[model samples]
Target: MNITPSLKKVIGLCLPLLFSISAIAQPVRPKANWQNLDLQADGMFGISTEKAYNELLKDKKPVPVIVAVLDGGVDINHEDLKNVIWVNTKEIAGNGIDDDHNGYADDVNGWNFLGSKKGNVEFDNLEITRILKKDWYKYAYADTTKLSKDELAKYHQQQKLSRELNDKLEDARKNLDLYTKVKTVYERVFKKIGKQEPTLEDFADFIPDNPMEAQVKMVTMRELPKAKNFKEFYAQSIIDPIKFCNEEINYHLNLDYDSRDIVGDDYNNSNEHYYGNPTVNGPTTTHGTHVAGIIGASRDNGIGVKGVANNVQIMSVNCVPNGDERDKDIANAIRYAVDNGAKVINMSFGRPYCTDKAVVDEAIKYAMSKDVLLVHAAGNDNEDLDKKANYPTPFYNDGGHADAWLTVGASGFRDDQTLKADFSNYGKQTVDVFAPGIKINSTVPGSAYVEYGGTSMASPVVAGLAALIRSYYPKLTAVQVKEIIIASVVKVNHNVDIERKGKIKHIAFADLCRTGGIVNAYQALKLAESRAN
Candidate 1:
């Protein structure tokens, strides 16, 4: 699949009725830069990016900060991102030699761990599927009597995950069928109406000539008011959801599907680090491009959306695939970013399981030794992470947490019940703070801009604020920066609506995260300046 739909899109498939109703009653679109707006000055729950730049950073000379975006892939050549894209100054481009002698040859930009000389791995199996596939033959037909205690536990887990995967795959197949039928109906309606892109007025005035026409008309009339045109509705409602289902069936849940050969690395070798190609922008760059733009997309550029941090270089370290990223790859990516002088690393991907967490834990410790801060996204599962585990966590096997790590949840633009993003994963002990992630406008592939919602979007917001702080205060340590950001959060002291166990519940906003508030760039800068003085 050339297009890799995100996990949020899959969740949307499960709640189509709720989303459809919301679409029918959708409000006017917020400003493109609403995520950067100040809460006090603009009445939007943003990071106060503009106010900080205009006031605190107007006269101060900023030191350039390198922030590594460890995601799927980034379009380094994006018009708004080109100037801010990090360049390996010592290495020459297209020389077919390891110019910097860092094991990666001709790495002028950054490296793509997901690609080899053949091509990039656009999609791969999820962690659960990989776990099931690894021990399938041994336990698929083994007798329970022959298994030892540890082996029996492993076998039971395998069986449970197997059943879950089968059930999910079946649901995906059914959703695919349903979306395909709806798409066909939409096409028939459009063909009958003789319009490639119908307006709301066109849909409102549309009269049914047949049973199928009437059915589609009813659907479109309920849905078309929010969409600007039929093409937008068709793509969002039909095309993207169908693609998400296909991704689930063909790659994530398919044990027979393997793309590791494309990388040509020894699957058993955890020590192998210098194997991937230099193609940083893989087949799909939508997710990574949007993430990079969120952190540092050339603030002075007249076109496209403004990024969070200024005077920062975004290093593209492509490691994540469409599905769950591997532990070995994540560990290597963190080490690579830290070795290459990345002061802060943004990891916007996570899964529920960790096959080998020791490697990742060691990598995070390595980052801490180098005084590098790591910011991660609380996953979009909308669960409490204090009870459930998320991979690449700050808490190591030994007991101590990584002081340089920050876990972020998604916050929205409103101060009402919707302040916390409905899809954000939360935990008072696990998540550090919330940031603007709902309907955030950022750069995508081909110089385009769009709004996307996820904890993936929220992680970069905190990472950007960290970069902004580092840019102004060069003397602050990574731990100090992390502390300042958390200590200076804009506190929220009211109840907010959150969905738990498939039920809407009103909970204190303070209970959602450790900071009990949203990230504020302006406040963080003030605290950093005070500490510097």
Candidate 2:
């Protein structure tokens, strides 16, 4: 079986991370320092994607690479993404028996750690919500069966957990209602400023090198058609305050977090030989599908936007949920991707609380052992990771350096006006680079597409960039790619233009983030080429 397919069949591999490739139409004489190039204007955003494709092809090579997406299932049948699925030639599709004997019965595309042979993934939360309310009806709050004194005490203990969860839910519901009210008021005020959309249309494509436009881009206003003050409207119009509040509530406050009670198995071990099915996609694969499209969606597919890399293979490793992901599943997914021949792993999700570190931490060590680069999201929380805590970090260098893991944060759409998004996490201690993450148009399930924002979107942009470097340079170690991304990021505007309190603040962008820059493929190519020498 020729597991190494032709590079032409691969989609994202064509993007050359090195300048010497066919894509580098006019290269400068080689130099020692890594070169940098601006990509926002020269990028493939506004112009026809085909024209961008040709320019890239002139100095690029299409190579196939595998990126493991440890998130909700990926939409395999997406219109712009159908051609890039990583098919398993080692085993026949839909075979009841494990033909390849790799433990999974028939992983045609990749394994789904979250599902079974029936292919369902709408599982519950991390903490079970069932115990609450039901037991509230009980008088003695005991199972009322033949129970010893010790057993009776245990029953009450579990019942207490139920009460705590219901209280948490009540608080969350109240918070949501409050946020919705604030957002509705702002929506009306923002409309008086601009008649068309809720967002500041005046902010679009206005690349301001000056400070005044940047001013109009940072102010927040109350619920009134106040004077057309760009600064006041920019703050409220650009951010979805309710969405941010809800995401925070969902992760931290949900007391009945364990929604996975239906699986009927222990999550602490890997003893189960076969747990999932070949029909890997689930009901809600929007997040993974969006990330995948950003990395390797087929170009010139006559439907949607082009992916970052040109020729690459996408493998589904469904593990994370809408809620918190377990350490065991994450650890297993990384090992699985490495053992199955993935050169790059894109983990666009992160959690603050990980009590069990053995399975996933060992998996990180295993990925390093197998020479795979792991790209992870730096989280969406606006706190600085240096002072704050974030997991799945790449920094093992005690003396001030990075490891094999690269953490990326979200960069806003308008690079000039308060370029740093209000929701993106930043840190000189951990975060390596920033990328376009605001309202990105990407693939969704069933031949559809939608715009989403998060470090989830940023991680795969770097992952695709990693694929480009691996395909072109081939000799660069996974650790080296991590360094290149960090060192080669383009320093964008130093504008502090985000919402805080009831108004927008104008601060330097560099002050908000560690790198104070965004990822540029053009510059990364030059850096990769110069460093190779």
Candidate 3:
């Protein structure tokens, strides 16, 4: 059972195909079911949780609940989110010192594992970066007495890739900055020309060719306030991927190995604890803030959308950085949440694969040991996960998961089973359930609210439902709670067809996910009552 650091590297490279699953789109579904189901009236929260909540209210079990959100940082100051922030009793509020011994001090709200420094975010490991650093040599070359040609080929591939990534990262940074600048300029000009929202039809006679390439067009189009013109301006500002590729090749890829660069800890000693204080929280919370609001922003405050869990405390864990989350930080975050008392967890992030399998596995195992129900997003890549292995999977690195883990995918406005979102990851065997994901409005940083997309939005929907179940049916174990969620969804439009393998393929709702249907909170409570009877 002793795995060296080198062995972990080999498995990561060879297992590129490990979690490669297809995300097929579903066919047309009936809209009547959606209309007949009063998403508002059905739930206690007066909002659709995909399942009605009012029915769950019959049992009359409501308590202050807690859900951990693992994502980019959350905006603690958001108008909708400022009220329900999880307070750490062990640590003092807003103090510079770590009085509590919870490892992360001053985490009064949450942690921001990914700090706001743009350059600080590391790039994902691509084939190219492995070459320039020759870091791949240690993993691919176990013995130097006899080297394989394949090894040499890999080195060459890495070299070529390193150059490309360096170029990519730099270009990406510049383009991001440039686009914002150009957008500002364009907005300024568009407003001066057209005080009100204008239409693209207004410019039918005037066309800007190679619009995206034309900086002039970007400036003019952005100022127009019309829906069509706004779309046109958006299209014009799109930067070419070429710029980002070259920069990534130069900076992060060509850089040397420095594991100590991020958190300033000795990564060599995984058992060495007491390196951090408990007073950590997020700084740039655009993504996490929105997700928190979806799970438990104060409802009916006459501001934003209703959260699924009414009386739940949201312990914002700042584990995910702007890039992929470090296994060590995530592991620690899991333990922190569990040690502090979190029953339901929501993870809205995933990497292409797990770099540190042991670290991730142990953390997930630890969470289960506490009987926590962990829910995760199926990813936004639109690939099938049945075969493809994404990082932080419900199952351990070995592909066998302990119960209490649920993998959720995105469902759209369409009611048919065939209509899996064009952006959602699907697997008849791997994914556990589905929820609404399109155009979700949630809280953001600076007390603002904006609509966002991706299965990232879909995850909180289920986590909230899981909380509601636990709130009403406290007798149910984590495993039973997962089962009730999967077994009770209404299979109204079971048979549907959607895109798969570049062609339309027919499938049943049960075939799309392990659960076979979207979550129905209303049915869940009814089932819980029956079990009690």
Clashes of each: 0, 34, 66
Per residue, candidate 3 scores C-alpha lDDT tens digits across 1-533 of: 11111111111111011111222232222232231134444321112443445444644757777788876556666677767777777777667666676665566765544332222333333323433444654544446345488866655565665566556555556545654565465455456446333354443334444444254443333333321234432432222222232333443334553323545566555554444433234433567777788788776588766777667788887666433456666777777778778898888877553446687688789888888999988886657788785567777767778689888877655555434655577898889888766545667777765555467777888887788778766777777888787877655356655555555567676677877667766777677678755
Could you tell me which residue pairs clash in candidate 1? none
- Candidates ranked, most accurate by lDDT first: 1, 2, 3
lDDT: worst 10-residue window of model 1: 11-20
lDDT of 3: 0.59
Query: Positional deviation of 228 in candidate 2, in angstroms?
Result: 23
Writing each residue's lDDT as its tens digit, candidate 1 over 1-533 gives 11122335442211122133223323344565889999888878899999999999999999999999998888988999999999999998998999888999988888889888898999989899999999999999989999999999999999999998888788788778877886787777678778878876777787777786676777776755534356655666677778888998899999999999999998778888988988888876788899999998888868888899988999989889888899999999999999999999999888888988888889999999999999999987777999998788999998898999999999878787778877788999999999988777788889987666788899999999999999999999999999999999999999988755445689999999999999999999999999988
Q: What does the lDDT come to for candidate 2?
A: 0.60
All candidates' lDDT scores?
0.84, 0.60, 0.59
Give the lDDT of residue 17 in candidate 1.
Answer: 23
Off by over 4 Å in 1: 1-27, 208-233
lDDT of 2 at 421: 48
Error of 2 at 495 (Å): 3.5
Could you tell me the TM-score of candidate 2? 0.70
Better by lDDT, candidate 2 or 1: 1
For each candidate, what TM-score against the reference? Answer: 0.94, 0.70, 0.74
- Residue 141 in candidate 1 has what lDDT? 95
